[model samples]
Each structure stands twice: as C-alpha cells, then as structure tokens.
Target: ALLGQQETNLSDGSQQRVTQLLKTAEPGGLYGAAGDLSDALPYRDRPGGLRAIAQVHDRYILAEQPDGLCLIEQHIAHERVLYERLNDRWQLVPLTTPVVLEGLNEKQLEQFERLGLAPEEFGPNRWAIRQAPEPLRDRDDLPDALLELSLGGNLDTAQVAIACRTAIRNGTPLDLATLQTLLDDWQRTRNPRTCPHGRPICLTLSESSLARFFRRSWVVGKSHGI
Candidate 1:
C-alpha cells in the first residue's frame, strides 16, 4: 500500500531501508513471542516498563518505554489516578478553612452535599465546604470544581470534578523523583489509558515509527549480521 504523498518520492537507498523496516515490523509482537512479561519485559527493563526522562513544556511527562517512547499529559494522568482513588476508597479530609463556593444555586449545593462534598450554607449564593474528598482538600479551584459537579447529579461526574480540581495543574514543574512516583502510581491503576473526560493520557511513538522517521532499517533481534 502507498504510504503517502511524501513517501512516494523517497531515494533508492531510503526506499531500501524503508522496505527492510516494513518487512521486519511484525504485528501483534509487542510483548514478543511469549506474549508475557518474562520475554516481553525482562527484569532488567526500565522500571514500570518506562523511565521518566523529562517534563515536556512543564505539562507532559516524557518517558521511554521498552518498545518505544511515550508522552503522558501530567494533569490528566493524575486526574485519572485521583478519580480511581476517590471512586474506590471514598476518602475524605477536613479543610482547615471551610471553602466557600459561589455561583451555585441552593439545589445545586444540596446535590453537592449528597455527593460527599459536605457543603453548608455560608451566605447568599454561596456554600461553605466543611469536608472534601482527600483529593480536593488542597485544591484552590473549589468554585470551578463545584460548578463542574453542580451540573451533574451522579457520583461518577462528581468524582471527575473532584479529580480535575485536585490533580496537579499544567505548567507546574515536577522533579524527577516526583514524576517517577506519579508514573509508578499511574501504571498501577486499573485503567490508565484515558482520563475521566475520556481524553487520552499517553501518546506513544513505537520503535518502528522511529525507524521510519530516521529512514533506517529496524532489525528484529540483537543479531548484527548486516
């Protein structure tokens, strides 16, 4: 099949390498022949099957996976982590100063309280949050969070709002240790592919893709006969 408009004009040497790469790129071989961690991911492989190289643009976590490279959006990854935690454990912590959330109607406040927000009437058009989910206790965007929850009446949506508010925001520089910890926790989650909003958290670039970009032949094994 034709690759694309740009690929049709490759030089003879580049075309040869591309052909070699395509022939060696096998399908359904991600985890190798055994299709198990034993063969696919050896003991000496990078921890968690990947290593955090850097924080790109202070928002995404640039990591190197065993088979390729990946970029993880920090905010969404943390949000997914927090959402699962809140959903399963339902942990709550008291706020030292009750958070006053404005722009919520009385009925909305009632719904918020039912969803574990623990908000009480503070003043006109505002509610004081005595206790919040552990994830939300440190967030300063309570108003926005409350607003996100106000529109929904289900527990699932409430969890999303709490997670979004609690997760580390974009542009916040994370140290290598912290980034690794976050990625480690993220890898353990039941569903780490997407966030609460259904946004992809990780973008992967396979080794084959890299080879194609560099116009180099990709060898299947460690053999160096060529």
Candidate 2:
C-alpha cells in the first residue's frame, strides 16, 4: 500500500509509476536514473528515478523520482524500528548498566518507579554495570548517559531516546559484520520501517514519474512529431 499522503500536482500516470517503482525496488538500497530534461529542471545535475536522500527536517525522507521527488517523515520509521530492537535486545540481554541517575526530584523518582526501575539498588549516582542490550556495551560514560536519560518526563520516552542515541553515537565504528548484523536484527524487528520516535527509515520514487515531471514526452513529441 502507499505509505503516506498523496501529492496534488502529480498526474495519475506519475503517481502510478511511483507506486510501481516503490513496490519493486530493492529494500535498503537506493536506485536512480538521469532525467532527460536536465537543461530545464533546476536540479538538473541530480540523478532521476527512485533515490533515497539523507534525513531532512527530522521528519521526512526526501527522495528523487523520475517526475519530481517525495518526502517521507523520519520519525514514523525511527520509532517503529527502535521499539522493536529495544524489545528484542532487552529480552535477550537486559541493559547491563542499570544506569543510576542522581538528583531526581519527586516527579522523576516517581517516573522511574513507574518504569519499574529499582532506584534503591542503583546506589546514589552509581548504577552497576552489568549486561548491555545488543548494539550497546558497558561504556565508561555511564554517568553522563544516565544523566541524559533522566531529562525526559516519562520512562518510556526517555529510555527510547537514550537507547537510540546510544546506539547511534557509541564510539566503535560498526564493521561490515556488525553492520550486517544490525541490519539483520533491524529486519527481524516487528516494525522495521520506523525508529522509537516514529521516523521512517527511507523513502522512494520512480523513473517514469520523473520523466513526466519535466514534460519530457512533450519535448520528444515536438521534436519527433509524435
């Protein structure tokens, strides 16, 4: 099914072509083709077809299509993937650090309590390091990490954001093996499309859609007498 809202300006043919391309393109890879009307389009240098762009505006996944391009909100995809991964990894191996957050107000204490976090056992800004969830390890900066975690109001939101930041920011560069493992783990997740904060991982477009956007058919017809 089409994942997001429809654009108004696009003709029916462009939309259909976009749908078909998205349905067929390989997962986790970008695809592109050069548009014929390179001279007319402002972004003439850009390649055409389905192509995923970097995360923009923290919301949408901008992708170049044959006709034009599209934006898929990132948060939707981010939340789904992060939630699943956290659950899966935690089930296998719980968070090792047992992060101890200090100087919590009554509200913060209550929040952690609601999350079932045992504050008493953590021992005053010194949470014990134990088993870290997958893609995480017992790092030295546990204190700072916990401090950051404590900022959010709710346990679920705090934990999810912390986990995502941790996973993304840990110093160790992921090797090919690790990258593949991560991808594999991510795929196994219930909602591989999004992260914990509800962001889409990627977006797509198609070649035919791009061609129509630049009125290439009209140009060709005029030149060749269609």
Candidate 3:
C-alpha cells in the first residue's frame, strides 16, 4: 500500500528503531495503554509505544510507530480530544474576569443564551458575559465556527465550537513530552479519526508501505499503535 504523499519520509535508521519499539508498544485497549504513561516516550522501552520524532511544518506531529510513521494534525487531534471531554462533562462556570461581547446580532445573542453563556446587556451593542462553559472560558474567539452547526440547530454545536477554540492551534510548537500527552488524550477520544467538525485528525503510513516505498526488504512485525 502507498502512503499518502503527505507522509514524511524518515531515515532507514529511524525505521530500524521503530522495529525495536514494536516490542514495547502496547495494545490500545478499552481505555488506552498510554493514558497514564509519563512523558519520557522517546526511550526505546517507554510506554504508550509511539515515538514522537519531530514536528512537520509546526502543524503536524511526526511519530514513529511499529507500523511505520504516523503524521497527526495537532490542532484537529486536540479538538477531538477536547470535544469528547466536554461532551462527557459539560460545565458552565463564572469567569474570573468577565468577557464582554460587542456588536452581536440577535442571532449571536440568542445563541449565547441558548448555550448558557449568561450574557447580559452592559450597554448598546455590548453584552458582558459573566459565566460561560468552562471549555470556552478565557477563549479569545467565541465559537464563531458554529454557523453550519447552528443552522442544524442541534446541541452538539456547543461542544464542537468550544473544542475548536480551545484546541492547540496548528502553528503551535509542542515538545516530545507534550506531543506524547496530546496523543494519549487523542487516543482516548471516542472518535480519533475526525474532529467534531468532521476533519481528519490522524494519518498513518504502515511499515509495509514504507518498506515498499523505500524498495527495501523489511522484516519484523510490531505495532507501535497510535
């Protein structure tokens, strides 16, 4: 099988290390094998299995798995993780310093109310938000990505919007430890492939595919499952 062109080509030496990693990469069971694992994931026998290599364009995380390599869009992956967290425990709490929204149309105002933002009119064209969903608190952008979801008029819009805003942006830099933690949370999400807004979050290049691409004889079977 051919890996997507977007798949990063790692060194054969890295591939060899991944082969060694397969011996330790635990299966992703009901919860997750790496859920409580520490950040020291680059070592040969560390838990969680995926060996994070480096960032691709500061947007995607490149990790060596037992298969081959997995490129994960950090922002969308975090969105899925946050969305599930919010869906499981949606909570509204008062902001330490209230957020104020200005120039909100009636629809925007109504949407805030519906989402339990507790917006109160402070003055003309301004509403002070005393309380908001914990996921949305301190967020600079209101979940403005909700146009399509709101048109559907479903409650799921709330979680999706907040998750998108709270999630790590594509350009953010993440260390290996942080990358491993993010992957851990991402693995535990109900849907790991797509974010709440329906964007793909993960991509994989199987070891077999990499071998074929490199036109080399590859052996050893292990799954550093991501």
Q: What's each prediction's TM-score?
A: 0.66, 0.46, 0.66
* Weakest 10 consecutive residues of candidate 2 by summed lDDT: 34-43
Error of 2 at 219 (Å): 3.6
Of the pair 2 and 3, which is ahead by lDDT? 3
* CA deviation > 4 Å runs, candidate 1: 1-47, 99-106, 116-128, 218-226
lDDT of 2 by residue, 1-226 (tens): 1223333446788787986654444332222343122222312333223345443543344555555555444344444556655655453245643654556666655654554544554666444434333433456765565455445566457558656665543233434444334433444556554466543454434346567767788797687755
Best by lDDT: 1
Q: Tens digits of per-residue lDDT for model 1 on 136-183?
A: 667677556656776766888778877887889999999999999889
Write model 3 residue lDDT over 1-226, tens digit each, in one string: 1223213655588886874454233222212553211222222343366667888888998888765677789999899988898888988888787766667787766776677665788998877877767766665553344332233344577778678778899889889889888877777666665678665565666676568777665323434444
RMSD of each: 8.9, 11.8, 11.2
RMSD of 1: 8.9
lDDT, residue 195, model 1: 87
lDDT score of residue 19 within candidate 2: 60
Angstrom error of the Cα, residue 19, model 1: value is 25
Worst 10 residues of 3 by lDDT: 35-44
